[model samples]
Target: MVNSKIQAAEENLIHVYNRFPIALEYGDGMYLYDTEGKEYLDFAAGFAVCGLGYNNKELNEALKAQIDKICHISNLYYHVNCGEAAKELNRISGMDRVFFTNSGSEANEGALKAARRYAYTKKTGRFEFIAMEHSFHGRSFGAVSVTGHEAYREPFEPVLPGVRFAEFNNLDSVKALVNEKTCAIILEPLQGEGGIHPAKQEFMEGIRKICDENGILMICDEVQCGMGRTGSMFAWQDFGVKPDILTMAKAIGNGIPVGAFAMTQEVADFSLKPGDHGATYGGNPLSCAAVKKVIEIFEREDIVGHVKKTAPYLEKRLEEVAGEFEFVTGRRGKGFMQGLVFSRPVSEINLKTIEEGLLVIQAQGNVIRFLPPLIAEEKHIDEMIEKLRRALRKLQ
Candidate 1:
């Protein structure tokens, strides 16, 4: 039976998303409550955005205080939280300058624009970008242009031109795509929607070297794998390689709609100046306040350290669970961003898991992607496994 709220939402909303049947009312810690007050262990973390989990006192208080003070002062002038948030992001991400956006897609859009602007400024005539096959960037025109999935790009034909796709983790394929007109090579250090594929260390190093040799910008879309989800500030940090431009979102604001694309000092010096790019609500005080508080909580609580400690346990349990399920072929991913590869489509299993009061999501390649909150502990992992086992048993 459909609830009134869900029915109303469906009526009012565009038919873009195939939303889950659960209509959540609130959440606490690692659990979410539906309108009927059924408790559900949240493993999806709202598609890897809500890192701090639900009803965080510190995060809530920060937003309340900011609401009393100011929300939107526009980008025409400076604000307190914006600069502080950018500084903290820079301190953690190793990038020099940042331009805030409202979502991950916008961050990628800004990054692509910055890359083009840098080439334009350099008079290099480099206008092309090399992106990875099976990589997910975003849905916007600029972002979708470089996105490798045919389904994402086919509907929006003639997206930004001069983009080529290379097989992920294949240095030779990436090299074959590079040319004089290649301005940037963009990839996710750990792909989220593309089946939890992590870039090989050699592949990362080789891309960095190629970019260095060819004067092409290396853009890392850390939208899903960044913000300590990989037990590092950015997934690229894990590879010991740095991108010329870094695009991030998802967990940065801990559920608030905020994202940022940062650049090296050299790229900043040459790209997106005074009138080049801007956003009306991008760096507004409200979103920056959220970003500021989230980072503060991460540092004070050592969220990354917690993830480093807990990830191995999660991985071990997933391995055990996969071993128990005949259809589950294997597992992959880093830190809390793990996935179990199944021999068949995960849609029915995901629905069954939700019915079993465990919230998990799906990815490409018939995989069940698990992006639990960064604050998830061993007990949470155990509970998730138990519930998941029930779902798998019923399905089998």
Candidate 2:
């Protein structure tokens, strides 16, 4: 049955990804079951999208209730949930206004636009952006233009101009690029796709300070690192720095499709007018309901505290596995988002771990990223490390 499904995907669907050889049927808690009922310990969590884990009862109920009432009512009309979702996000993120989008890409796009438009009123001819190397924003033209990786951008040459690259975690490099034409400096607080590297406190503070001194908007791509992954509503909170604009997605709606870019009242005022930007199904009723429920669940359960508690155990377990496996080069990241860097390519270990019923994310080709649900317990960490041990033993 799984084989047939894979064949059908190959025959009918576009060949964009070289997916793992299992058809996930359903997921519950920290585990996913395949079509054949083989259980896989889920550390990937759909690349940090499934923060509450799979089959969340409250979230399911919320979506179901909203489905019965109304699933979508585009931006032309009001959905109480839509406004409520934005209110909740603003209340937590400290941003003055919110613009709902469809994905992290769209949110980043909005952030970029907000930066440029705000700069338009503040400074003359400030259209350039300085982004960090090794950063992965998204695949959209604007998002990809700011993304620093060569491979992701090389495909779509002649990307949105006025974008320059700087080394991540280096303040001097960013300052070197800042000139009269610079509008914003964008970076991930903890880079998810670029090997799970977290910025140091000084670096983050420097970025914030630079943005302030230069009148440049500091835009954080919190799509992967936000939603309590780093033991806060937003990862920038850990650094004691607030962004001029922040973009969040992935876990914000649990598993639903919703994203948002928020900014200060000043930026929001100058950014986009009625004719400038819009999304048709951006903040529909159903997705906003999911967002509300997810935020409520996080607050009620103290999900950030849960991640903070379990993260040390997860890190310790990964360290032990590294001590046992010589190929394990290092570990990095904060809270629930971490990566085990390998001496060689991670492709073998990734597949081997999947074969042994553990699902982890492969990042930057040589790192195995663990982005477990925020609800993951110590037992889940133990299971993940034990399965990783099995996979590493195969290599030895």
Candidate 3:
């Protein structure tokens, strides 16, 4: 089965993902079982998407129940689950409205469109947005255009115009770029693809202040950092700042492909009209069921409290690894969304760790990112740390 699956993917699938030499078939809790029945510890959480872990009993039952009831219903009509999901998200985020999409990229695209429309409503020709350097939004044309990595943007040139790049955590730099044409500024609370760099408290406060003083819209793309992956329900919650608009995906559905962009009451009131923007597959019943269930589980299980309690143990273990390894240079991020920086690229370390029966992920700046499920306790943390240590020892 493993060989057949690998061969099938190699023959038919697009060669975009840098897939490891493993053919995984199933997962339970924080462990994944390959086609060969080899169990491996999971720390990647499917790139921070599987927050509830795999085959969660409640989630499975919910999905089964939803399947028996209904799955896909077009956006032209309303579904009960979709409305409930939107209401729950709004309650959690303090946002007034929700627009769902198939993936994080589409959610961010929606937010950008709303921003442009909001600006046009306020004043004509307000199209520009300020994005930060080393930030990753998504891969769609508009999203990639605002993304800071030149490599991702160079080949896909002529991306949306009027977008400018600014140094992250530098309020002065952001202030310098603001003008009448500027409509919004989008950033991640903790940059996931940019090596898990969490925003400093002062920086987040400054961004909020700058946006308020300038009458500019604020966007926080929490695709990789939301859904209680951090200690708070959302990364922005940790800093006591709120955004005019917010985009979320990944763990929102705990592996189900669901995404959403939200806006404040005033922004929703003035932004895109009925005919301006829409998604055909957005907010379908099946996906909405998953989203609603994930949110409910988080609240009922106190997943945020678990993350807040167990993250320090993971952090201390990572710090100890850094102290022991000469090549280890720095650590960044907070709560469960953490990364360890090395003086050299961590591709080998990542591969070696996978071979050592652990799954991890990589980010920019030689970062080995650790995003375990919110259910991870001290035992999982200790096991992950020991496996990581074994991998690092191989480098020596």
Candidate 4:
């Protein structure tokens, strides 16, 4: 039965999201069942946030246990779980320090502030940041300022000044935009919302070189591409390029709200003095406990290895389906974060796929994004592909 509450929602609530006309009740594994008891294969994975899949036992248990112990504690006092989570994050990321936030945008905000502060310390008048075109940072003022999408930033005109845009996957464009006045250059190793465009190897190396030569801090926003989503623990590691600072969120806590920014000791030293930045709910005990368990599960299950082994199979299946559809232009991206570009708009296809009992997301440039949970089995992949095939046939 469709809930009357949902219908009421459409009438009363703000229509921020033109959401699919279905109310999700619960989910298990890679499947979400709607209020009407209809099952749908979940390939979007809650916009790439639910890494362990729906209603994961371990993650649920961790949350339940934490709920009994403690839920929220301000950063005014030392918290055990938050401290431990920071240590673990530093260990995993090979960074000296970690500052936690509640979302990816907040983490990026911290990174931007830190970059500006670092520049201030060096007596460098550089305050500008060079971001890639089509990049999708969060909706916060600082994040949207650096984001490349005009649609998202159009309404909120008069954003922060000194943000310059460069072309994604184009190193020369980045080189041309970055100068001594540039304090930082931020990019996603794999562009997510903009489209699943992986940074070319040469481009990755080139950005690092530019940062090195210009003394600019290289900030990699791994909010969507990190946390074992891209076969590797960090996507930057895959290209053998390191950043002075890195921001992460999404799957970090396995759906628990937690985000972090890490930086080298030197970079963290400048601009981020005591009381420089803080979050009210950041680094809370409950979120940190979830993050700890998430990391443990990743290590014990070898989730990264699983993604590497299975991604090619998933990609092959997607490619095969693409070949059958005349609308499919090409496929791009890395590991589990793949995109199928189509000659036509994908919004109709996305809606139709939902009706066919599958859930996926449409990216910019008319691409259908596939970000299944890293723990998903081959059976789930096959199910998703089958649904996609059915949707394609209907579209044709």
Candidate 5:
């Protein structure tokens, strides 16, 4: 029987998520408990947002202490948590200044504004942006303009014009799209929602050269593949290419709502002046404290190194599972952000997996995305593999 309280929530709430039809009451490490107390292995990790895992002791303590102190304060004033968080971000990202926001889309919005403002200052007649086909930035109006998926853009037509699309991992496509009218070339180093495709090294280097030649800014959207998700603090570090502007969220504040955009000192000073842009709860103490602790734990626990060690094991196990199924096409992605592409449509498989108590995310192009927490242990990996095997066997 469905809980009356949960049913009330379903009735009252807007249907944005179209969730798994189960009410998650709590989670610990890589497992979640439904309202009925059924435990499920969570490979989705709140859609890749929870990096450190749920109910982490360090994170809980930090948040509790901050709650006792202060939850929020406007960005108009100086805040200690904001300063500390910014310092930690700068250290981690190698960027100069950070603009805080509440979500990944907002961070992308800020980056877009910065690109335009930079062009405006130069009077370069460069108002257009070049994005990639099958790329997902965010849902905000500015972000949607650069997002390449037609379905997401169709309903919200006439979204800020002059946005162009190029083929992802295809340097020639980007070169052809970029010209005098381009203000920036924005893309993810690893495409997340577009079925976990990692940008080739040559492709990234080619784009860097093209952007430099065209005098256009390069922005890397690391919202999903960043923050130790790809066994590194930022995915660009893996490619050895640095963007003029970087946008990130997801694992930044762990489960807390926080996002950030960073740029070089020159770009930040010239493009993003004070009073140019701001968010109400952007740099609130609560979010900042959470981010600070998240970074601290990532470093102290060597979470990235742990992911590097564990990812290969998970990948090998997934390969073995795929070997058993004729319909399994291939595995893609890096570190913990892996995807299993199937020969057949995966919607039925996803539903069956959910029924068997495993949580996975469905991505475009018949792929099942796996984004487990960075702190997931060997036992968690084994559990996920066993559940997936059971689900696949039943499908056969």
Candidate 6:
């Protein structure tokens, strides 16, 4: 049964999302409490956005302090935290310039624009892009255009022109799509919505070589797999192949609704100028404060190191869970981003897990994607697996 809060929300808001019945009230540590005060062990971590977890005292204090100082000041003037945030992002990402956006979709949009603008500036007459198959970028017009999912692009019939789909982790497929008009290749190093498939090291190096040979820009969409989610500062760092353009969001601000697209010095010099792209609330003081604090916390606490230490345990526990379930076919992913493949539709199983006091989410290919908080420990993994086991038993 839906609670009063959920009912009220449904009545007022557009029915775009088929939301769950439970109305989340608040969170403490890795657990979320509903309106009726039922506790749930969160494995989704708000779709991997809450890296620091819920109600973190230090993060909260940083946000509260920002509120006390000032919140929204337009980008016309400089704010205290924006430059600091950008510097930290560049320092961590190894990108030369950063442009902040409100969400991953916008970051991707800016990235697409940057890639095209780079070609335009160079007078290369190359505007086409090659994106990976089964990849999910975002829902915006340009992001959806190169998304590579026909269902997503079908309704939006006329997407950005000159874009082609390529088989992910297949260098030949990407090479086949490249031409004189091909300006960029965009892919997620570790695909999140496409079933947690990590790109092979050789495949990554091959793409870099192809881009270098063809003079095509490489863009890595790290919106889901970045910011310590993959036990690296960015997923691409795992492969040691740097991209000309990189997009990041999700855990960047630890839940502050901010995203960014960064580029190397070469790309920055040739791409999107002041008149080409602008976001009004993109780098607002409030969001920058969150970004600044999140990065500072990540550095001070060595969150990436923690993920590296804890990920093996997570993988081991998930393997056990997969072995226990007859329907579960396999387990795959990197660090905190893991998935369990099932033979049957996982929608019912997801609902059942929630009933068993756990929260998880699904990806394509009947995948039960596990994007637990970076703060998750071995104990949390044990509890998550046990709760999931209970849910699976109920289904049986």
Task: Find the candidate with the highest lDDT and give its number.
Answer: 1
What is the Cα-based TM-score of model 6? 0.99
Candidate 1 TM-score over all chains jointly: 0.99
Q: Residue by residue across 1-396, what tens digits does model 5's lDDT show? A: 777767898899998876667888999988889988998888999889999888998899999999999998867789999999999998999889898999999999999999999998888989999999989999999998888899989999989899999999888888888778999999999998988899999999988998888899999999999999998889999889999999999899988999999999878867977788999999899999999999999999999999999999989988988888999988988999999999898988888888889999988899999999888888988988888988999878
| Cα RMSD, each candidate | 0.7, 1.1, 1.2, 1.2, 1.1, 0.8
Q: Under the 3 Å rule for N, CA and C atoms, how many clashes does model 2 have?
A: 0
Model 5 quality (TM-score) = 0.98
lDDT string for model 3 (194-264, tens) is 98888889988998888888888899999999888889998888898999999999999999899999999
Report the Cα lDDT for candidate 2. 0.91
Per-residue lDDT of candidate 2, residues 48-143 (tens digit): 999999999989999999999988775888889999999999998888899999899999999999888887766567999999999999999999
Steric clashes per prediction: 0, 0, 0, 0, 0, 0
lDDT of 6: 0.93
lDDT of 2 at 263: 92
Q: Write the per-residue lDDT of candidate 4 for residues 255-353, one digit (tens) a residue.
A: 888999999998977768877898989999999999999999888999999999999999999889879888998999899899999999899998889
Clashes of 4: 0
Clashing pairs in 3: none
Candidate 6 lDDT tens digits, 160-220: 8899999999889988888999999999999988888999999999999999998999999
Q: For model 2, which pairs clash?
A: none
Q: What does the lDDT read for residue 222 in candidate 6?
A: 96
lDDT of 3: 0.91
Tens digit of per-residue lDDT, candidate 1, span 190-215: 99999999899999999999999999
Which residue pairs in candidate 1 have backbone atoms (N, alpha carbon, C) closer than 3 angstroms, thus clashing? none
Q: What value does the lDDT take at residue 273 in candidate 6?
A: 84
